[model samples]
Target: MNLFADIRLAVIAALDALVAEGGLPAGLDYANVAVEPPRDALHGDMATNAAMVLAKPAGAKPRDIAEALAAKLGADARIMAAEVAGPGFLNLRLAPGVWADVVRAALKAGAGYGRSSLGKGVKVNVEYVSANPTGPMHVGHTRGAVFGDALASLLDFAGYEVTREYYINDGGAQVNVLARSAYERYREANGLEPEIREGLYPGDYLIPVGEALKAKYGESLLGQPEEVWLADLREFATEAMMGMIREDLALLNVKMDVYSSEKALYGTGKIEAALKRLEDLGLIYEGVLEPPKGKLPEDWEEREQTLFRSSQFGDDVDRPVKKSDGSWTYFAPDIAYHFDKVERGFDQLIDVFGADHGGYVKRMKAAVAALSENRVPLDIKLIQLVKLFKNGEPFKMSKRAGTFVTLRDVVEQAGADVTRFHMLTRKNDAPLDFDFDKVLEQSKDNPVFYVQYAHARVASVLRKAAEAGVDVSDAALGAADLSLNTHPAELELARKIAEWPRHVEIAARANEPHRIAFFLYEIASDLHALWNRGNEEPALRFVQDDAAITSAKIAQARACAVVISAGLGILGVTPAEEMR
Candidate 1:
């Protein structure tokens, strides 16, 4: 079903035959050989570097090997022509029937069309949206949530056993600040003046948490010392914030397989155990770190601390695990968390962090490398900022969140599908601008609407054909004489459909789900182009005077929908059945 893959296999077989016939030397590695769309479409459908890569290894001139490989490939029924280009590159043009077969394959596969087995069912843990348990998720967290959720789904579609996880930052000082803020709100709920002081959360969202706290504890803990109530209220507020975060994620239809608490890492000996493993590996040492490279902090001093030899693996410098005061540094728990993931036997670990965490990437990677002894691979994706705009101006801040725009605000205004799709229009590490009016516009320039419109157009085609008494069922369309689809425009769309499976594997292999959005936009562009052509070209219409031809044409449109729907599913967007 993967046309490019099939063609690559044919090319490999041709090379194998060349080796067998003694036309080429024996024992040449073909692993570096690749077949892909040419940089310029006019060059050919696909271009392979099989000869270019093997010429030196096989001890033959590039031209001679390319000519030999060309002859073998030209004999393939699937390849219409195989010609050698400059420096021994072979350009291949597939037989026209191959594109027709792509339509049949898409129709036969339905929603499973682009699903790939690229990951080989390896266990992958994707941890994202681990926003501090302080308040509602903001727009920044929204981007991370959407990106990570889509990536996990993409990996799963590519046959990875993906686990969506959220690591709660409750053990940090932020949670302590949250407890004090909630305590103030709890006082306000108990009919007293609340101190919404500096360095405290002032979001109106905490008012409800205050009411809940009052209901649970009444006035019994009023006026208690910070020591008496800090721990209890910290736990309480963290849970309350997590409840709101869960609701926020649900608004976007994101559900996690696991929720890990950083506070739990304390008192569980897990952090100590992780460090012990590092110590056993000789990666842990007690020493004074050199003063950091840049401007010295006001409290900077060279003090003895427990450090991890992170630089040995690939970090800017060694990282501290414990402070001079014997308290675990922030890096300690993160290492333990990742160690827990490794111990759980996940084949790979992916951390979705904000752009601000870029500096932590190397050290985190070094830790996982040392702890897992390089058995587990760690990939940390840094999600960049999402700037919000309405019309042409910056969107106002969320009063509920007290500073930034809340995830709920964005989702409620634009709806989940629009928000998710628009968020992915750019790379994860690139900044994105979410303009409410632009994304909801019913224009082809808007990818969200454009892609959805393609699916809806296919739906419209099916409805029209069905009303005209054409057998538009998948079985009937798949059984249609697809060879009747002879129009160049129609076959071009089929060719695009054929690229879906290949693009899925490519996107999944790169761990970049945004590429799926990019591919969806491209294929949608092809569908829209063909749909427009139908307006002036009657023969290109989906519903024709002849029911059989109508079935044939509608098969192509349905095939378009099949790949579009499958792609949108990976992005967690519902394929629109009709355009509004």
Candidate 2:
């Protein structure tokens, strides 16, 4: 259960009682009131701004209202003390039994301990890693994949119906380049000297595709001109590249619910329909854009074209849907793709894009806004680059991925779990340095290792309890006399455990799964601190001389393990059961 929310409700009930007893005003808006961890632990467990937030509206002095509210809250059995601090802020110290109850609740719930219903099961579509179907996924798309996958899992844990999607960039000029590149390999496979010209993909990964083409068409396509084989090779090579991409994503344990093709939207009338809808709403127009504020771009032109009134919806400027040559601009197909999502009736949409695509964010949001009529909100998260290092030196490039490091290369070097957790060590928009040596180091500085060690230590405790002939089953652990776990160090850990549900809702509401990682690190730190103290104090050890005391102590450790497992699940990492 959410102890913070329960406490908040208790505070609300106390305020209601104050109003009823004529101790406060008859009507006061309590929506802005908040109960959160105090800024400093020296004050109390939780601090509420009820008096500070209501003093002006209720036409009463802040200290007077805080003193009155303190009396009402002090009567709660769960709150040991409610003291008015500062001008009006009320700090609360929960009863020792409350922390004990949190530990029991955690053991009872296991992996479901921190799950939240904040999303209310709303339908959400998360589209990510929409890289061009040209080559294997590189480190850039790797960050996007991990961030998006973790975010989708977080939303699912928060009770959202999340659909992971990938929009293939196959309808662009990049696919044609991939086709021509494979053709050179095809010639080489047919025992002819291939022309690996400029602007063609030179990666050796396409050698198999070339050999496959030779197997299928043999000499039939050998003598064909550009017109005859370009279309076929484009389709074939794009398919092969997508297959390779799927394997790359699998290396990181990522699976998309849907893989939409940009080519499919070309002739299906979807583009026309999306634009027609915009046109009917008077958002489509013919206009010439002003030159960029700085120096004009090399390809700048003032030709009039069909544009979407994107500026009306907060875009920097109006965006064009059709080029001057009557061909669909890249924005046209993208608009149609988002319209397709809007028509699917998702309550919300989230797009995970690389930091290089920052320029497209405002316009894309404007398109979704105009298409969904502002009914569906869209959030675009831009993931920054991940720089790889090995022992203070820059990591070498991937031999398989040509210029950039491949996702599979990173996963093969560092296992999937290490890669996922290290990638999220920083926020999505912050630059992360993935040091091969540092990440695998068995030190507390390494957050992944530290957190995993905490979980593994719990496992060790469980094994010891079992060897001691104590019942360590979930039922027994949950039914243990948790009141025995009242040590300050032990209660601090339980208090951290009590904050797990609060963290889940906060992370879900912010749409930032990285927060889960940070919370895991904090809770794991608490667990580790308690573990360290147990080394010096025999009473603090998880395994004791008596079965009842041992059970209570092990229960506390197990509760920490349960929450760590749940957090790691959101991060798509398997919790470490045993340390190497």
Candidate 3:
């Protein structure tokens, strides 16, 4: 039960009653009316803007409307008090029983407590970490992978039919680079000094590909021309690299529903068909673009080329689809790829891109808009960079990836769970500092362990209660006398628990999974606060002298565990049963 929503409904009903009593207009729009937690906890349990929002529309004074609405709301049993505040804001204090009911609801709902249906079964395709299929995923792609996977899980929990996807960049020059790099490995495997040239991937991760090439063809491909062996090696090397990427993603507990290849769109008429569709709509034409504003390239020329009128749909300027040499530009295949997604009948599309791709956002949205005729909406989320630190110093780079760190290196050092949770400690757009020493610290300063410690403490309490001959199973704890939970600290936790459903809808609507991590941290703080208070006042402890009291208190502790488990589940991190 969403107590906040229930209270909003009550406030709306009171406004309707005021209209019936001739205190307000009958037809004032109430869409802007909202009920949320008060900015200050001392204000009240919840606050509503019904009076302030309706005053002008209903042709009534703000305070007058607020007083009338407060009187009507205060008459309800669940509302202990409703006071009209500055300029018609209405603050409400809920009956203590409302919090008790929330605790019981949490126990009954377990892991399903905060699941929402806000998405309403809409099909959303989330494409992320579509890195070039040339090597194993590095630290840059790791952030996208974690963010996308968590978002997919969040949307799924919030009732969206989500498909996790990866678009492979196999049709670009990058694949040809992979082929040449593997050929060197092939020669190296055949006992010859390989030319590890410039402009090609130099990571040792591809050593296996060279070894595999040697096994497949031996010395036959040693003296062949580029044409004779490039095709087979390109296909073979891309598959192997993708395999390694899949393993990297799986290391972080991520799996894509589909892996689309740009190569698959080549020579299949898909690109031509997509451009033709745009051409039929008068969006495609041969034109010359203005030189970039700041600095023009030395070879810049105003040459005629096939272009898409991206500015028609909100891009800064028209963009070239085909170069002057008649070859498809990078944007051409991306347009075709998105067109293929739209044709697959997806109602919505979400692309999670790195912050460097910020320039591509508008043009991509324009492409989807023109292709789908604005029927399908695309949301692009840009994930910023993650800086790593260890022992109060910046984490150094890896020689293997040449200039950057690899995902496996981070995971192997900081561990997957710590890495996942710490990456989400900040919003996607904000910079996050992953300090290896700070994250693993056992103190409350570390959010990951703090949250996990809360769950582990709950398990400890359950074990202690069971050993004391008290029944602590879910069924028994759920049936306990929850009315005994009247302490302010105990009731405050229940109030936080009641906010879960509200938090889920907010995070999902904003497409920010980082909100879940923040909420979990707050919940864990409340749980830990109560645990520490038990030391000062023994009555606040989960295990008590009497069986009835123990059951009631332990039930609340278990309820906290239940919510934490559900939140961690959405984050794809296993909730700890006990701290090692």
Cα TM-score of candidate 2? 0.98
* Segments of candidate 3 deviating more than 4 angstroms: none
2 against 3, candidate with superior TM-score: 2
Error of 3 at 538 (Å): 1.2
Rank order by TM-score, top first?
Answer: 1, 2, 3
Model 3 over residues 253-365: C-alpha lDDT tens digits?
Answer: 99999999999988999999999999999999999999999988999989999999999999999999999999999999999999999999999999999999999999999
lDDT of 2 at 283: 99
Q: Is candidate 2 or candidate 3 better by lDDT?
A: 2
What are the clash counts of all predictions, listed in order?
A: 0, 0, 0
Model 1 lowest lDDT segment of ten: 539-548
Q: By TM-score, how accurate is candidate 1?
A: 0.99
Clashes of 1: 0
Pairs in clash, predicted candidate 2: none
TM-score of each: 0.99, 0.98, 0.98
